[model samples]
Target: MSKLSISQAAKLKGVSTQTLRRWEAEGKLIPERTAGGHRRYDLAQLMGTKSELSFTVGYARVSSHDQKEDLLRQVEVIELFCASNGWQVEIIQDIGSGLNYSKKGLKRLINLITDHRVERLVLTHKDRLLRFGSELIFSLCEIFGTEVVIINRTEDSFFEEDLAEDVLEIITVFSARLYGSRSHKNKQLLQELKNVARQL
Candidate 1:
């Protein structure tokens, strides 16, 4: 087997040198060390492998357009994290209620996962992906051999407030459908319920 230097190995793998280093550190790939203390990768192992390569992506979401700044901050953090790890990351952003899974960005993410193109997913927080049923997505990732990386565990109090609003919105929609939106009595009831929801 021929030996390849770090740069050559990185080029062959189509990843950055830092990524190669990280892989080594994570024991995913360990190179032979020279007497001069330089790392050398086996070219055959790096290039002749039959395993498929998958892509990495970062995802960010906000429950409303008012939280656009927060979403941008999440994107910045994800970009910085991927850059530090020397990963070329694709970022997906969504502006919608977490309770609603029909968002365009969320659908795109699911399609990518279904296509087996995603090797890894990075999220700022678990709730950033979904207000609920996040574990379901995690299970799908596991089935697809995709790794999930959550950068922060810190809870945002405002997220709970947003979730309450989402629940209220869902309730309002259903109630309107059941009671008839054109009814003045139903509209008054919805206004009263919304006021109560805001207080919660």
Candidate 2:
């Protein structure tokens, strides 16, 4: 019959305060409101059966096929982190430009989020999710009551290289659109861009 504050409840449940908030939004575990409108949870109720918990998702990505080794490393890190937290996680991996939204793995991840099948989404780094517009996905997670866990929030060393590749992808797409995909001009423009990127 003990009532616990949000933080206390989160600690007792081995999850984050944000995850508890998300659960509240999903109507999975609505808490009582204090006189100050703060959330309070029943200790026994907070420790729900494992069957009621949703699974966690670990997402790992690298910018190109050549970085397959790095992708595996990312997966390993995510797995170890989840294991340390005693979280049951499914790892989704992608080997493509971070700017590409149509990656099969990414699509699957988004579908899982929209379906509310994921309790949490873990990532090695923010940019691994996307080079740009990652906030949009994070917002979707918020709406779907999915908590996002970034293992390393600090800037990564290969960020510049990945960014350069993403930039090249953008230029390639635009150039193709402007002068047909098979056009000589498009090919020449892309080559020049690639050469410039190489110099930097």
Candidate 3:
């Protein structure tokens, strides 16, 4: 069996290396690895499938200044999931709030999608890629005629699961820290936010 390196496979398919990595993480596609712990793609994996286009690409992201914190752990989880499932991925690291559309890594991902001329996407979760409401982002994906698969979505309730309540609690803690260190109305807002968060 002829094995192709990740880069060679990407170059052959004319997609970005990053996109392949994300697909791998989303449990959409997997690549065989070389003896040196390097990733290799099978040419047949990119062609001759029923879809007549066996090529696949993946994209992953996390938004936090402390990327090495929980974000890094999340990446590791996604990676293991992809590796076990025989998928390829593209990893993008950004150190900013997800609310920022102009994030450097995100922009690169967008460009790679357009530049590569593919129509498939993979994400860990909808919330990971989008923290805020993203009507515009959805529209862009539609315009690109892309089919996206969220490998690990919080809303996949049919799977008998949901975002861990602890995750939301951590978010509440961050919000509290941001506003609690204040006076007057700030304290009131903190209390209100806490109440709302508790309700969540």
Candidate 4:
């Protein structure tokens, strides 16, 4: 029932308005035309392309300090998957912690969903998009009929941090609370964890 203008649809699909217009002319991405000769796209149709539908939409996010510094690489991975399936992606970038909800980047992403511009959101990892409880985000996405996909769930042993990653992260947090320097507690936490291991 919801409709998006050609421009809006173009952005959601990661294409130009002219491309959409051209596609409409060539029957590539024909949206329902209004009486005024304007092209309007249906979000539902765009999401389900198998049954003669339109391009599906995808969302991606990452923090600033992540080792995967290049968000484009992440976007390309997502975009390639979507593109192969004739889907579109509206990528958003932000520089902050995943646990922080007041992220400007995430706010814009939520706004896009509110405007019915997103269908399925894709994240490389749950921690990339979220850290703690993300029930509110999931609930809003559900309410807006948007789905989420975590591309990678299994932990990567490649990271030198290994299983102690989360534990180290916790130590960092606690250290930050106790003292301004987080790295200061890393040595202590490592020693303590090693000591505890020896006792056990």
Each model's backbone clash number: 0, 0, 18, 0
Per-residue CA lDDT of model 1 for 1-200, tens digit only, reads 49999998866665546557656775778899999999998887786642245677899998778888888998999999988876678999998888988899989988887776776799989887788889988988877656788888788656867776687868766885857658888777777877777777
**Candidates 3 and 4, the one with greater lDDT:** 4
Please give, for residues 1-200, the per-residue lDDT of candidate 4 as tens digits: 47998777765665445546645665656698899988789988765533122224444544445534455666777777767646556567665555567788788778876764555677655555555656777777677656666666785322233223434444556555555455666667666875553343
lDDT of each: 0.79, 0.83, 0.57, 0.59
Q: How close is candidate 3 to the true structure, as a TM-score?
A: 0.47
What ordering of candidates by TM-score runs from best to worst?
2, 1, 4, 3
Estimate the TM-score of every prediction.
0.72, 0.76, 0.47, 0.49
Stretches of candidate 1 exceeding 4 Å from the true structure: 1-53, 178-185
Better of 1 and 3 by TM-score: 1
Tens-place lDDT per residue, model 2, 1-200, is: 59999988876665667778777776889899999999989877877724254678999988888788888999999999998987878999988888899999999999998987787899989989888889999999988878899999999767978877787777876775756657787678778888887565
Candidate 4 deviant stretches above 4 angstroms: 1-57, 66-70, 153-200
Residue 101 error, candidate 2, Å = 0.8
Cα misplacement distance, residue 64 of candidate 2 (Å):
1.0
Which structure among the candidates has the greatest lDDT? 2
